[model samples]
Target chain A: MKQTQALNLQQKTIKALGVNTSDAKVSLSYLSVAFLTLLIGGILGLVQGLERAGLMELPPWINYYQVLTAHGILLLLVFSTTFTIGYQYANLSHALGGLLPKVRKFAWTGFILMVIGVVLAVTMVVLNEASVLYTFYPPLAAHPVFYIGLVFVVLGIFACCIGVFINYRHWRKNHPGQTTPLLAFFAMGVFVLWFFASIGVTVEVLTLIPWSMGIVETTNVMVGRTLFWWFGHSLVNIWYLVATSAWYVIVPKIIGGRHFNEKLIRLVVILLVILNIPGGFHHQIIDPGISESIKFLHVFMSLSIAVPSLMTAFAMFAVLERAGRRKGGKGLLGWIGKLPWGDVRFLAPMIAMIAFIPGGAGGIVNTSNQMNQVIHNTLWVVGHFHVTVGMSVVMTFFGICYWLIPYLAKRKLTPQMNRLGVIQTIIWTVGMILMAGSQHLAGLLGDPRRTSYTTYGDHPTALSWVPYEYVMGIGATLLLLGVIIQVYAVINMMFFAPKGKTAFPVSEPEDGAPSAPMWTERWGLWVVLLLMVVAMAYVVPIVDMIVNAPPGSPPIRTW
Target chain B: MKQFLYGLVLYLFLLLPPVAALLESIMIIHMHMQMPLLILSGFLMARLIQLKFPDFFRKWNSNGVPGIMLFSIILVYWMIPRTMDEALTIEASELFKFISLPFLAGVPLRDSWKKISSAGKNSVFIIFIILFSLMGWLYIAADEQICNNYLRVDQITLGWGYVTMAVCMAIYVIQLIFGDHSEYK
Candidate 1:
């Protein structure tokens, strides 16, 4: 009878979230698309780097801004979102015990829409019809289709988020009184935050559609800009949350650590949900019409949101210490040596965290009302985000993909592939250090971001930036190499590798499940608080703006 | 369906340059009309879209984050003085205000907030309180015209309005904090 029961459990586990093979296919498709896009984005990055170095002559068809925009859109938005969604879906479904109703459909629909949207947007971008850069600030208008395609992509994400929500609800129903699985909790937190945060972009996109299509004769450059930042800042948090989720749930287990305090982790996620949305106001510190007092308040709120990140930092290190010490290592710092330095999964996120220290610190300066004036549009700001989003989040995603692709493909990671993964992480980390370091240095010298470097026709002072740009260009080349390796490795694992099951490792807490207050799972309260925080940050300032009107600017294309 | 179309029509009417400028010429209507209408129109569009794509709506926004966030953005955008200035002066800007508000802000929010938790509602209140207070302080402190169209006195009055609303919000928050007496067993 015991044997029979064990067999039954194995059968259920094989199905893993009742959705069956179709779910795996959906996940794989997303992963594939993500990597494919990464390949193209990586090549663009290489070209941009070389172009900055003055190493290559530009093709007649390929403009700097156009390539830059494609690079940003594809890698930053497309690659990150698709990879995160795919990985999270697989994890959430497995943890939740099955796919909930309509999830398969949602995933497929989202994927298809995303693909179509990417095609529309990228085509126009390649044609140089939309060269407004990824931030796409207007009076720099893109082709109408660019905005429209973005709308579809956002809607696609919306659909996927819905599926996750449904699965969460279903899981709750099925397991009354049980603690929500940590992975699912993390995924849900990200989805929830993203749902609200995306509104900024949605508004921007909707407004752009009519303006670009000539339905609206003029656009309010300031409003469009403000809306972009609103969306823009939230998008950063979304990336952070994605990477953090992996840290909270996956990293501990992989490092042989028991779960960091689960309730504390939950609370951290909750705090992030509420606090992350309004922090976007900090980005507008240099922008006009917003009051000094409000900007100051945003500064405070921005600092407030940093609390969770701080908490996460503590929680992560504490988990590492516990796991390290438990493996018969002595002394306060001695356990560091005991960690799995070999596995790419551990090394990648660890590297990401190390990068985040400076990245996060730079963020505080970026948010500082007075200090922000110094670096508002400088390459220092560029370095800050690249370190934060580029190093931290992108690296974390790469870490997840190492094991995740193999698992989804029903294959064991070959030793060669594992070795390649480790090399990729190291190369990427080293490259980023070189790239971001130089950017920060150059930015301090008053070098602006988003401009192609040319030695001709500049003040003598401007010549200082050339050396740093050269370093950055070199860094970009190395990073491109890592990107190529990562793409190649993932493709091999997905298709050419041998088939077998890999563990979906989730660590258990050190002292078993500590009784967490049920309120830890109370998403309602958190959501409400989040909404309130967002409203307070945005409402009055926006209202004040509308009450007093300025002459609106018409859209103008520089290209 | 009727409501959706009506909302759209109303939205378009508000976008007309003369009508929009006339509304925006006043300090109160300009902020209240242009900003809230963006949300209202968005809410309406969300509702209409839901009728056609119930599955998508139910699956995605049933929890209210998407709708609430969308509405919040529109509300926030028009509140910026620059947005208002442009809407009043630029025909295209005014047109966008009309379409975006009702469709993006109004439509989605109407559906979303319904299923949202009371906690969510309370949070929205808190946001308003903080926003109003800051806005009030800024308006009151300003010696010069912040918006080109509005008088200095109007800015002061708006400041007062914000201060008053903020006070009310603070009181309400205090009340909720003191009033709720649920015991965990």
Candidate 2:
């Protein structure tokens, strides 16, 4: 035991903390839940895809809206959140030299809460008690149980967030005055964004409960919606930050490259924390009651969030190019082919980044006040998020899982699984090309989203959407098939594969910078600044909303 | 026994909402006010029951996992919008709510939470978080009225209430996690 302890200390700080076994279990549990959700969500996606193609008819009991809601909730919320927490737990423990035991307990609690919440909420959706789409905008009511279940989900995540903070604090005390590890810094950014961004939903929900319970006769639609968007926009940023973390930290290592300048990365993360929340105004650019000036200001703020992303692109490419050159690759762009294309880890994130180019560009278009009018609520917007969240975030997560499962399960990655992983990435990329591409094209043609175009009855405009919907249907089917293979590979690797340990690749920083800026670690200053930015973005409009608001609208049930 | 008195207090606390027409009259009040009170009361009642019948509590909830699971199950049942709606519209449902909150959910949770592993607590935390968000989505997204007494829009607004509570609870959990660490040192 003493010898092992000595060796652990010599190896890395994370192992010294002696929580890997438990951390592995914790992470695996979370990953399992995420994968489970993905499986269910993937099947749902295929069903919807087929439905869109007009090939398979959905029964009356399970309508398009119900399928759509399940698809969104399971994939976007359940899958992503569970995957993130699991990833965070695994990486954070290793990076930070191990978490406090107490923190780990909190993580477990959060996981249980999340599972129960998902089951309850999804049950309602399945039973048709809550046919409300994932957004759950007001004036639409579902079962109160659905709302309560959702509350548990949020709280469950909240508990996990708490675990993160606790562990962070414990680490800070143990290594006072030292800089936190790169991945931990990234995780911090995610949680901070989550905690801050959640305020929007919090405000929206608080108001909603009273109104739903009939405490109030009417609901102020503008207020509730504004608040929802506030949370909504930030939530996307949180997902972006997760993908960004992998891009900044893991991608470099996976490509045999060194880390980017740690100081700059930290600054970027901090900037994201402050800037991510205020950008919600971009989602509300076209909403009434908010002044045009305020909207324009938000437009600018929203544009600013892109700066870090741009920085990331520059930094990532530099790292990759450097790694390629070190491997004796010849020219500028030639280095790209030199990287490990066959490895699922490199391929998935790479394709995701490529997808982001268009996704990010689309975002810029969405942010522009006048331009948004052309494609707002269109298929284009749907395409944009799928590219960003679906392709970028979800794809990276899958790549992480490829390695993570083997590591956590203490199993070797079989040749079959490795081959499957590579194929999954390729299939995903191709599927997204067909799916998101057609969606973007259809969106540009003023095709509406979230509608069964084939069932348009006699609407002449529906003709334009039919072709794209068919293409999307084909793409979605391919994508879901890829998901099935991916899931199978993961399960096989975790349970059925031969036993062995895998290496966790953590790279060193390439930039030989002396010391990180002190201000980077000054969380207080950054938080204050974040609040300031938020106030600048929201204070005027909210005040105006309160002072000159119209009469509250009574609830209306369309269905 | 002092334990029984505590249980009595829990029962009284839970009964307050329905007796006063608080649970039935307002949608948010019923969900936010009455439901949580029920859980809290049940939590206290569990403690009392544990004290009064240590053997039974020990056998059922010594490790806390089983008891907590039971608590979670009961809580999940009560949280359904249908259950809440029924409680308001039907007399028997209200009585059940009163009984379930304190005796079934609250008491067991109180007993289980103490014995549950930290991992278990973490799971509990996540469950509540997801529940809150799910509720938020349901209330906000549903176009039709889930509750007879409430308008469809009001239901949507109520969804926001769950969202807000969940967020606040999350923030608090973070504080608790960090707060305990500092104190431990």
Q: Provide C-alpha RMSD values for all models, in order.
A: 14.6, 18.7
- For A439-478, candidate 1 gives per-residue lDDT tens digits of 8988888888887757658778788788888898899999
Task: Please list the residue runs of candidate 1 whose C-alpha ends up more than 4 Å from where it truly belongs after superposition.
Answer: A1-20, B1-185
Estimate, for each residue in A118-189, the C-alpha lDDT of model 2 and write its tens digit: 899899999887777888877787676777778778888788888888777666655655677888888888
Best by DockQ: 1
B102-179, model 2: which lDDT tens digit per residue? 777777777777677776787788889999899788877777777777765447546766776676556545644544
C-alpha-based local distance difference test score of model 2: 0.78
| Top candidate by TM-score | 1
Q: What is the TM-score of chain A in candidate 2?
A: 0.95
- Candidate 1, B72-115: lDDT as tens digits: 78777876767877876787987787767776677777877787
**Model 2 chain B poorest ten-residue lDDT run:** B176-185
Worst 10 contiguous positions by lDDT, candidate 1 chain A? A2-11
Chain A TM per prediction: 0.96, 0.95
- iRMS for model 1? 6.3
